[model samples]
Target: MEEFTIINENNEFKKGKVISVFNISNSNREIVLFSSEDFDSENANLQIAYLNIDADGYNYISQIDDEKVLKEAMYIVKDMIEVINNG
Candidate 1:
């Protein structure tokens, strides 16, 4: 459970733990999902973020190529967080 320091658009800094890092099949790109304690406007407990990675470096924000991919990541993170909380 590695943690990272994130700086937001307001220049606010937050500390979060890494939940998972994964790559889609047949793709060289890497995506990292992390959890922060800060809640969004909706007040979601687990604030999940994905970093877009390329050959050059990481992009500030990431876009989902497919809706299924976003859904899959949500499921994966949910399961992982469950294990961490209940196990």
Candidate 2:
């Protein structure tokens, strides 16, 4: 499993598993899906981040603040993984 460190709105870093990676062909963008399981709270939080690749090929997730977009990305990631697994 791939691991990722995500920064929340408060600028706190949270470590999670990289559940999925999505490529946006039209825009040349990559979206990463993260699943942060909080065992203490018995909750699983989903986070969506944009993978920004520099000219030299170094990449990182950009900061995001839209909840709606994050939720949509989570759905997209789940669907994508489901399709891949089913096929």
Candidate 3:
């Protein structure tokens, strides 16, 4: 898994290991799942972050707060699981 650094709105920094990546169909956007003690010491939750990948392969991280986007992401992940299991 790749490592990632997160800079919150308060200018605080956190480090974590990337769990997985999912590309949204027909879009340049992707969601990366990662985990860090900075989020929760017990690691009770899985956190997700979004980014936009440009044509040149550059990516810019952007926080996602929209419910519809999140629901779509969840469905994408579910579909991925189905593919893996059926394979």
* Candidates ranked, most accurate by TM-score first: 2, 3, 1
- Cα deviation of 81, candidate 3, in Å: 7.0
Question: Once model 2 is optimally superposed onto the true structure by TM-score, how far is the C-alpha of residue 42 displaced, in angstroms?
Answer: 4.1
- Model 3 lowest lDDT segment of ten: 36-45
5-68: candidate 1 lDDT, tens digit per residue: 6676788666666656766664455556766555354331345444664678645445567667
Task: Say what the RMSD of model 3 is.
Answer: 4.1
lDDT of 2 by residue, 8-36 (tens): 67775666787667864433557877776
Tens digits of per-residue lDDT for model 3, 1-81: 266676666786667676788777644677986665465455433666796667898765667787777788877777776
lDDT of 1 at 38: 53
Candidate 2's TM-score reads 0.56
Per-candidate local distance difference test: 0.62, 0.69, 0.69
- The collision pairs in model 2 are none
Query: Residue 44 in candidate 2 has what lDDT?
Result: 73
State the lDDT at 33 in candidate 1. 77
lDDT of predicted model 3:
0.69
Q: Poorest 10 consecutive residues of model 2 by lDDT?
A: 20-29
Kindly report which residue stretches of model 2 are placed more than 4 angstroms away from their true locations once superposed. Answer: 39-42, 54-57, 64-75, 81-87
TM-scores of the candidates are 0.47, 0.56, 0.54
